[model samples]
Target: TILLGITKASLATDSFLSAASFQETARVLTDAAIEGKQDSLAGLKENVIIGKLIPAATGLPRYRQLTVAVEGYKAREVDELDIAAS
Candidate 1:
C-alpha cells in the first residue's frame, strides 16, 4: 500500500482489515498457534502492520504534515509516559 500510494498516489491492494478483522483473525490464528499449525500467521500480521497498513493509514499529506508539526508533542508524551516506569 505504501508503495502503491507513493508510486501512484493511491492504493492498489485491499486494506479492509479493522478492529473486528483483527479480533477474528487473531482468534483463529491463536487457535492455530495453540494447535501447533506452525504457519507464519503472526509474521504475516506483523508484516501487514509495519510494512503497508500503518504507513498508508497514517501517511496522508495532511497527517504527514501534522506528524512533522506534532512530533515534539508525541516525543514529550512518550517521555512522560515512560518516565514513571523507568
Candidate 2:
C-alpha cells in the first residue's frame, strides 16, 4: 500500500518544474537535463504553468487554419477596416 502511494505520487507528474518545486529538485532537473528533455503541453499542469488555457470539449486550438472566403467580398487589411468603419 505504501509502495503504491509512492509510485502514484511519483508518476503523477513528470514535469521538472513541478518536481523542482516538490521534493527532488536537483535530481529531477539533472535527469531532465541529462536526458535532453523538452517540456511538453501533454499535461494540464504544463499548460497552466505556461498560462495557456486547457483544451475544452470544443477540441480547439480552434480557428488556427480558419480562412473565410466570401463570395463577391473583397478582404481588406485591418487598417482599411478602421477607415471603412469611420
Over 4 Å off, model 2: 1-3, 6-8, 11-21, 57-59, 63-86
**Looking at model 1, how many pairs of residues clash?**
0
Clash tally, candidates in order: 0, 0
Q: What TM-score does model 1 achieve against the real structure?
A: 0.21
Over 1-54, each residue of candidate 1 has an lDDT whose tens digit, in order, gives 234334233122133222214445565556555766532323334445544322
Candidate 1: worst-modelled 10 consecutive residues by lDDT = 11-20
Q: What is the lDDT of residue 63 in candidate 2?
A: 34
Candidate lDDT scores, in order, read: 0.37, 0.59
Give model 2's TM-score versus the native structure: 0.45
Cα error, residue 74 of model 2, in Å, equals: 18
Q: How many backbone clashes does candidate 2 have?
A: 0
